[model samples]
Target: MKQDSTLVFIPSNLIYKQTGYLKGCKKCFENSEVYYVTSNKPIRNTYQYQCIGFVGETVDFKDSIGNIPLFINSKNGQLSVENNSSITQILYDYDRFKNSDLIHNQSEKYGQHFKYLSEKLKTTREISQNGRNSITKYILFLVQIFDYILKITRRIHQIVQKSSTFAHFEGNITTAKWFLTTLMEERKITPKVGNTICAKIIDLVIGVILTTYLFEYEQQIFDFINFNTEVIISNLRGLLLYLMGQPIGLKLNYSYNNFLGRFFLYHISLWRIFLQGLYPLFTGYFKFLVLPGFLGFSYQIAMISDVVSIATFHSYCIYIYAARLFNLQLKCLKSLWRVLIGRKFNPLRDRVDSCQYSQDQLFIGTLSFTILFFLLPTTMMYYVVFTVFRLITLTVYKCLHIVRNTMQTIPIYLLFLWIVNASSMAGNIHIAWKSFDDRGNVKIEAKLEKLPLLESVKKFIPESESPAKNPRGFGEIFHSILTGTIL
Candidate 1:
């Protein structure tokens, strides 16, 4: 008996195209009765078809959206058979059964993508952090340089106030050179490498020397005006006539006690270092006690002293105020007397000759003015030359090694001074103009209001705006631009 090769079932509502008998088969089977699963709606219907074929033979089935193909047993007409599924079924089964493999592949892909992104993010963050740190350090370094410049400027101002003559300027120049050298050398090895060390040294030295020369030239004019005619005549004539006349005048005026009194007189000099040492101790007390009690008391005292010193220096020459000229003159005369008179025999002559100022005509004509007249010029010249030379050498060194630009070589404090002066002038002008305008406006308004015709006109015309009412001035404009407030 042969089983059916094909089985077709027709439901009650469906039609059949083929209803043939089986041929050349061992068994023939009748078709199973078809049953339709129906819903209340006519469109919802279901049917099933089954066929038997030879074992291990390839079978083809129609591809439909809602169809499932299955193999059947041909001999027993049994529905049970091992199904060789479609590609879609194989993919679905693999996805369902291989859960660990799917998870592993997804995790590996995600991790690689995440690592790549993370590496990029880390690099970006590092660069950003480094840039911020670099900028912060650069700004801090610039601030230190600025502070140093301020300190140097203050020192320069102090030096200038101390000695008006060019000769004393040398000490200041030497100090400036040494300071700059130390600063540049330290900068080269420290937190910031100075880019213009050579240029700065060169420019500063040159500027100082030129300034000193100018100051000395002016000082010579000042000295010439102050010196007496006799001193000038003696210096111009180059004569020793003034030295011989001193002894006769001293013998005419001297008493024994007066002669002996000059020898025993003590010379006292004030030491600046003592005051400097006191400054630190006073500063601590100032910070802890004095400052809190009265704000800026110590600072005001310093400022007052500075002002007084400046006033004194401007009013009287440094040598006169310091008494150094008198001391130097006395020393010079004493040396001259020791050379001329024998040490034991002419004791009275030695005492009279050792006086800084001579009483006799010869000494008065030749060397009496030495204390004020000759010394001032010599001191001024010496200071001018020394300072100029020191400055020049320092400048050359700086030009060769450090400074690169003209602007960088200029002292920053000078520029600040210029700016301050200009600003002060501008402020004065602004204030003056504002005051004038405000006062004028009141008069104008009163007149306008009082006059009957003008008052009627004022009803139609707007009141004139005063200068005080005007918007920002030049200073405000400059400030706004500098602070980036009005961009």
Candidate 2:
């Protein structure tokens, strides 16, 4: 399923005639000598040349020959052939391909007609609401605005890139390399050791500022944190009580549910008392964390956040317990059902195999399956509730880290370069049509090409982690949720 990676050979004169015209003469190269050559050169001019047509390769016949379409089959990644036609153009690489204006006249002619049709379709969708809600429509509007701006910016960038005058600058190789390194990679202005020292200095300054502020209001911050912890504990206790008595209309096994709820409630109470006892130690530790925060690492701040989340450490423990119990019960139910059906799972083969179970074993399996099946709902309810709490905590932590990372990694150097002299940030080289020689050969000249300012800056900046892209993918999480598997 590989394409012929061998080179394609077409007449230079044929392409030259096609290059500078609004519409190329189809038969301009009808009699042109085009050959398909192999890369292997075991023999010289003794090798037979397979003469191809202007657009499609030809087959010799006794009297007449026919033209056949030769194209790459996208699905199979192979060269394919069909009769009577050839692929004149390929609309691949949609984004870059459409952005190009190499065949300007043809593109404009088609573009004008398609523009009206596109507008009509969009208007029709808008009138119909397209099954979109108000929020969806608003979000779509924002997206459209963003896309329009991006498109216009890219178009301008393309124009500048192709223009010979725009990207020309008088600079040495060192300056050029520095510009490219700053724009196309992480902005590294100094040696590695120097960068490390500079980073340490910045961290020290930030740490000092943060430490000064925190120390001044240490009691107040600790008091606020303790008060929030108490409120959270009270709220959690209330929730457990409500769950024990069926807050929702759905009926649950009251005795078992109550037992679980009371156990967690007791755990929470103990955790609160323990936390109160360690208030002084935690306060001192929190103060000490300012030093690491001053070192200006996002992960250091994340570590502090993790320690802060320990206020709900007991809730996390409950979640782990419930998740494990639920998971174990599910496994037990599955195994017992398999046993009842006289089949056992073989780990080595990774398949179920039939087995002859004794009557007593079958009875025991049936009893176990029935018990676990009935208790599953209760276990799941606890697991799901605690998982929600855990997710909320994680979301807050992730947000804080994202904010910190974003602030710390802002491309200030790239921004300054962009402001002072944006053309200096060029990372690409473009070959422009310079002139034609006396022999009618096209002369080309290479020029430095300007990269899109936003795109270049974005490249240099370390992006913050997106909340949607979690440790597990969306499909995995969805499957886990549907199957009642622990997150």
Lowest summed lDDT window (length 10), candidate 2? 17-26
Scored by CA lDDT, what does every candidate get?
0.29, 0.51
Candidate 1 lDDT, 1-487, residue by residue in tens: 2222222111112111222111111112252111111111112122331222222123244432233233223343222212321111100111111111011112341233222322322222212344655665665676566567656755676554443221122323443444454443333121111223333444456545544553456545334433432253334222212211233252222232233222212110111233335445644453342221122122222233342333222112222322343346445555545433422224756444332333464465445444444444333332233233333433443342222223233334323323433211110000011111222211000000111322222221211111111146668745533322321
- What's model 1's TM-score? 0.18
**Decoy 2 TM-score against native:** 0.55
Count clashing residue pairs in model 1: 21
Residue-level error in angstroms, candidate 2, position 395? 1.8
For residues 1-487, what per-residue lDDT tens digits would candidate 2 score against the true structure?
A: 2222112222112322111111111111222211221111111222232222222233233222223223332233222323312222211121222122121122332333223322322222212334436645554565565556545545675553332122111111122233334322322232222223343456457656776777789889888888888898889998888888866786788788989998998899899889888987877687665554554444345555656557768888898888788878878988898998889999999999999999999888898899889888888888889888877776776576565545444555556654654434543434345444453333333233345667655555533322221468769877766555656
Report lDDT (Cα) of residue 5, candidate 1: 27
